[model samples]
Target chain A: MTDPVAQPETAIIVLGCPEVPVQQALALYVASGLRERGTDVLVTGNPSVLGLLKVSDPKSVYIGKTLVLETCIGEIVERKRDCTLCIVFAHNDAGIAYAATMCHLLPKSRVVVVVFGKDPEPLAAEINFPCETITEKAVHNPAQLKTKITRVLGWAVSRT
Target chain B: MGCIENLKYEKILPLGASFKECREYVEKNYPEVWYVEPGYKLFDEYIIGLPPIALGIENGEKITFPYTKPCHGTYLLRIEGKEEVERVRKTAKTKKQAGYR
Candidate 1:
């Protein structure tokens, strides 16, 4: 059987812990990128970001566990739900990607992980996981925001 | 990130790209003048050749792609939006297969 980890495909889950508007803005932009592509964009953030995203009765389902820690591995696996993308958000100088590099059980083809940062150095990439793909997008200013939109659409169009 | 209200480490750091790849991107883009120390090491690991071709870029700068097993992978490095990836094509590089098309 083909290794499931090698082919990742799922909803884009923006992973990050946001405390400031600046950080939330970047993550939101990236999430919007995927959503614009018609792909479901799921944001996995802390209470601050989650609050910002607005936890409605429907979207407010508390995870009660973190996928990274495998706290509910069996349950998450069973409820992996049809995800087409997964974007892990981060801030500048943040190590979001660093932490993700250690995960081994991610379903291949059902995920495209990203660690959003404050800056652009690590923006838009394919690295880390042996079989998985990840990208980093940072939009610090208006010019960068435009670039971010262009690059994101480029990615979506290319994927299509 | 410094002061002005120190954000929690978890809030600052989110696991995403591998450290190796992030470092590679930094070395390829940032101006050579900005390199401090380890930047030179990254250049040595990810850069294609001695005196990398992207004009105006300095030499022997810092690099952070530490030598590690399975570190051999194809990387597209560009500076000022221009690529210097061709300069570092070694005979060994030819043997590596492309991953994540």
Candidate 2:
């Protein structure tokens, strides 16, 4: 028998700056990690990320410009209200701030931040948990990234 | 590395231990951004990206780092909206992929 916990239908990725493609790349790993964990994901961002994902994974993404924090929250809340578990990735500083603000917007939703390092990719963490950083041990290997992503997503989803 | 911080408009003024002083501070205590502690001055134009981007200095070098150095100048930049940042990033990505460096 499979685990009764069905995968989340929506994954909200919120990066702080529209300029950071590196962050977008990191988010892609994260979204991919989530997808492997059986969750459907949707990435939203300014034209930068939206355009990139459009060319990359167009179906599972939503590209928009200037989505107010509240409206973004509403969209996710409604989706989850339909009983689909939802997870959020506030990717960077912008994503972090957005996550904090989002907590107020959707009291029922859960937020996570998987901080990516400049050189070696960092570890992932859920909101309100002890987040690990990459500096401790270089996550240079690709397998480590997948392992970390799956670990973080599982850790995050279990709480909610 | 990515300009992951939110592009918000606020009168955020960062101050520190003369860049050099900050290094000492970090070495002894912890990393502290001089931009906002006690009192730092942000320019009147307050823009998006960040105080660094607004000042037209996007991660090159600080007047002081690892030790105390006098701040020569500060700026209050007009924040560029989301569209503009994307334009630059898009260009940068294309150039980087094509071996612009």
Candidate 3:
């Protein structure tokens, strides 16, 4: 019998509220980087965040597929959907909560949390789970976060 | 009694109580209730205090979860009714759904 072809890995990028300026830019950058690695990427967020992302990438060049945040969580909870890797972009306590929740839900999958804002250290400290966490203090400029994300992508690729 | 605006009943946690503290409280006080872990997005608006962590009972008929308002604080809301419970249950992984065997 012939050897079966392996399926590409899948990744879900969970985004927090769209108010933070760096979130949208970092999300797109990460999605693009993941896509370049031949991984299936899905960016999920609230309607407002989705609207902003869609408007930014109207042609869906960087963002391949998008799902509503609640719907995505529902699917995971019901064991209807899953991914090889889950990345959460967080800036506040709520973001930390979301990341912690994702860790519980996807115990088998690798979860990476990208914490950024005025005080990323304190917010990142709130996460008390087993996952790769990246922290940077970037509000309007995506440079710092972008570099950290690039390193994360490299590390992720090396592992898988 | 005057008209009840909603069917939901709530008990707000004391100030400075963390999510872990709230979960411990539920486990100690309401041992029969099973809780979904923190991080489930139960509300439409962005939660500023904590992620929506809920405790389910009565075969998913009655649920008590934490709901936080920006600058207001978090509340342990006890909502009765199967429909609402189902809605909350669908948002995050539960004990059974988490493959507790």
Comparing only chain B with the true structure, the TM-scores of all models are 0.22, 0.22, 0.53
User: Per-residue lDDT tens digits of candidate 3, residues A115-158?
Assistant: 98888997787776889999998999999778777665673345
> A1-160 in candidate 2: lDDT tens per residue?
2233445655555544434344555566766755666565555555555556667666654332224323344454444322133333333333433343344334454445445434323113323332223221222334444455555456445534
Candidate 2 segments exceeding 4 Å error: A1-6, A18-22, A32-40, A58-92, A119-143, A155-160, B1-101
Note the DockQ of each predicted structure. Answer: 0.03, 0.03, 0.16
Segments in model 1 whose C-alpha atoms lie over 4 Å from true places:
A1-10, A20-22, A55-79, A92-103, A110-127, A131-139, A142-160, B1-101
lDDT of 2 by residue, B1-101 (tens): 11212434332223321222232332333121222211111221111211112122122222111211111112222243444443333332121111111
TM-score of chain A of each: 0.51, 0.53, 0.90
Scored by Cα lDDT, where does model 1 land? 0.34
Give the CAPRI rating of model 1: incorrect
Arranged by TM-score with the best first, the candidates are 3, 2, 1
Measured against the true structure, the TM-scores of the candidates, in listed sequence, are 0.38, 0.41, 0.70
lDDT string, candidate 1, B1-101, tens digits: 01212311111112333444444454554343222221122222322111111211324322122211111222222222112222322211221132212
User: Alpha-carbon error at A50 in model 3, in Å?
Assistant: 0.6
TM-score result, candidate 3: 0.70
**Candidate with best lDDT:** 3
